[model samples]
Target: MQHFLNSSFTIPAERNEQLESLLKIHCHVFPYPAKTKFLEYGDAMDGVYYVFQGRTKHYILAEDGAEKILYCLSSGWFFGETPLTLHEPTGLISETMEPSILWKIPYSVYDKLLDVNKLFRTAIMNCMSRKMLIMRHEIENQVFNPCKQRILQLLCSTVDNASLVEGKWYNLSSHYTQYEISTIIGSARVTTSKLINELCNEGFIRILNRKLQVSKIIYEEITDQMDLL
Candidate 1:
C-alpha cells in the first residue's frame, strides 16, 4: 500500500552514526525492560530521549480510560522534545514495547547542541516535520475514513518486505493484538475484531501462526480506491 503518511523519518546511515557518536559523548545510556512506563500524563520529563534500540508506544489515556495510541517510535527515533521545549509536563504516556536501550540527553545539553550544531538542529527539524505530517494524516483519517479502511491501511503499512511469500502474501513486521489495533484506529475492541473477521472473509487478510499477513492484490486494490478519494 502507499504509505506516505505512515512512514517515519529515517536518518541516513552516515548521519545516524554521527548522531549516535554525539549521543554517546553527551547522553546517559540506559536499558529498559519491556512494558516499562517511561512517563505518564502530567509527569515531569528530565530530558529528551533517543531510542538506541527497540521500540516504544506513545499515547494518551482518555476520560473513559481508553488508550489512544499516537505512534510507535522505533530504533533511531527520538522523542520527549515537545514537553522539554515548552517547559511543561508531558500530556502523553510513553512506554517501552520491548527491551530497549535509550539515550537520555539532559534538556540543557540538548538545547546547547541545537544551538551549536547545525547538522543536529536540521535533523531534529526534519524529524519534527515528519511527525507533524503523520499526525495530520492520522487526524484526517479518523475524521473521514471508516474503521475498516483505517485498519487495513495500518496493516498494509506494516508489511515486511523481506518476508513476502511467493510475491503474494506479505507478512506483517509486527503481530498486533486486536486491542492494540482498536486503540490505534480509535475504535472499540469488538468493532475492530468484527472488521478484522470481515477482512479475512473477503480474502484481504489472514492470520497464520498468530502473525497477520495481507494479500498484495488486495492491498493494491484498497490503496487504489483510497487514492481516488
Candidate 2:
C-alpha cells in the first residue's frame, strides 16, 4: 500500500529533545512497511513505540471479525500506553498506515527510566492526557453531530487550510472508501455516499479526482451547527 498521511508531523517543541533522548535509550528499533500489523490486541509488548516516523490507526476487531477504527495516530505519537496500566497487552490492534520508524521500550526499562527521569514521566502523562481529550471529543462528535458536520469537523482537525478554502473539496492523503467513512460515523455506507453526494450537489463540498473540498461559507455554517448538535 502507498500510504499518504502527513509524514512530517514533528514532535511537540517542548519535548522534542526529550523524545530524541528516549529513542537513544531504546534497545530495539524497527522499520515497518505500510499495511503491516505492528501489534495486535492482547499481544504482549515490552516497549511503547516512540513513533519516529509514519502513521498508524487504532482499532478493535469485533467478535464478528469487523474492524472499527477508533483513531488515527501520526508521527511523534506513541502506542501501547493502555496496556501499561493493566500489565496486559492492548485490546486495540495497531496497523501501520505509512512505512514507520519505531523505537521500542521494554516495559521494565521504561518504568525504571520514568522513575529516574522526570521528563519521561511527564511525556507519558502528556501523551495519555492528549489521547483522553481526543477520545472525549470523538465520542461527542460521533454522538451528536450530523454526518456532514462530523465530516467537516474531521477535515478541519486533520486537513490544512481549513479556514481559507473557498471550494467544497479536499484530498485526504489516506486511502479510505465510503464504506470506511460509514463505519467511522456509525452509519451505512449508502447513507454516507448519499450524504457526500448531496454535499457535492449543494455546494457544501465536492469531490475532484478523489479530493474533498469544502466551501468556507459552508464550513462555518457546519461549525455553527456543530455547537447545536
Candidate 3:
C-alpha cells in the first residue's frame, strides 16, 4: 500500500489494507541501525524482511573473504525468501546501507497471507519475475561485457531512478564504495577507479560532494552501447 516504497506498481488500497491488518498482528516493525547485518550467510530464513525505509545490500562472502555484492535494495524489496522457500541456509548477507525501518513477519503469517490474499501473491510474483530478469542481465554483464561496460551498466542501474536536473542525472553516488562497486561489476578496485577518472576527464560524469551526476550525452552513449549489446 502507498506504493509500497520502492515498488514499480502500486497495490490497490484494499489489498494494502488487508496486508497492513495482517502486519499489525504478525509483523514486528523496528528501526535497524546503519551498518548492521540484517541477515547473514547460513542464517535460517525464519521470516521475510521488508524495508519500510532506507537501503540495503545483498552480498555473498567470497572464498578469499572479499564481499561479492549481489545487488542493492532500497525501500521496497523483500529479502530472506531464498532460505524461507527452499528450506536452506541463506546464501547471501543482507546489510543495511543506512539506518532503516524494517518489518519482520513470521513465516506462518506469510503463509496465511498467501492462502488468503490473491493481490499480495501477484505482487510477489511480479517482483520475483523482475528480479530474475535482473539476475539474467547481471550474468550477461559479468560473462560478456568488458569491465568499463560492466561498470557503466552498474552505474546506470543504480541511478535509473535518480532525479534529473537540466537533463543531467544526479544522486547516483555515495551509496557505495569503489571497491564494493568493483566487486559487483566483477572488476578490480584499481581498475574501477581508473575508469571513473577517465570518465570524469571525458566529461561523461561528474562527482561533487560524493554524489555522481551523469551528463545527458554520456547517458545516451551508454544507452546506445547497451542497445548494441
Candidates' RMSD to native: 2.6, 5.7, 5.3
Estimate, for each residue in 1-229, the C-alpha lDDT of model 3 and write its tens digit: 1111122111111225555555667788978888898677688887887666777778887788877777776666666765776778888888887998888888887777777978557656665666665576677667877887666655654554457766665555335678877877777788999998988888877887776677776776666665664
| Best by the TM-score measure | 1
Model 1 misplaced regions, further than 4 Å: 1-15, 223-229
Task: Report backbone clashes per prediction.
Answer: 0, 10, 0
lDDT of 3 at 171: 52
> What TM-score does candidate 1 get on C-alpha atoms?
0.91
Q: After aligning candidate 3 to the native by TM-score, how far in Å is the CA of 78 from where it should be?
A: 1.2
Writing each residue's lDDT as its tens digit, candidate 1 over 115-179 gives: 99987787677767767877887888889889988887788777676788878998977667899
What is candidate 3's TM-score against the reference? 0.83
Q: Cα deviation of 3 in candidate 1 (Å)?
A: 6.0
Where model 2 places Cα greater than 4 Å from the true spot, the runs are: 1-15, 162-175, 220-229
RMSD of 3: 5.3
lDDT of 2 by residue, 102-169 (tens): 77888888888778988777777888876776666667766777877665555544444433443534
Candidate 1: lDDT of 197?
Answer: 96
Lowest-sum lDDT 10-residue window in model 1? 5-14
Q: If candidate 1 were superposed on the true structure by all CA atoms, what would the RMSD be?
A: 2.6
Angstrom error of the Cα, residue 22, model 1: value is: 0.9
| Top-down TM-score ranking | 1, 3, 2
Which candidate would rank higher by TM-score, 2 or 3? 3
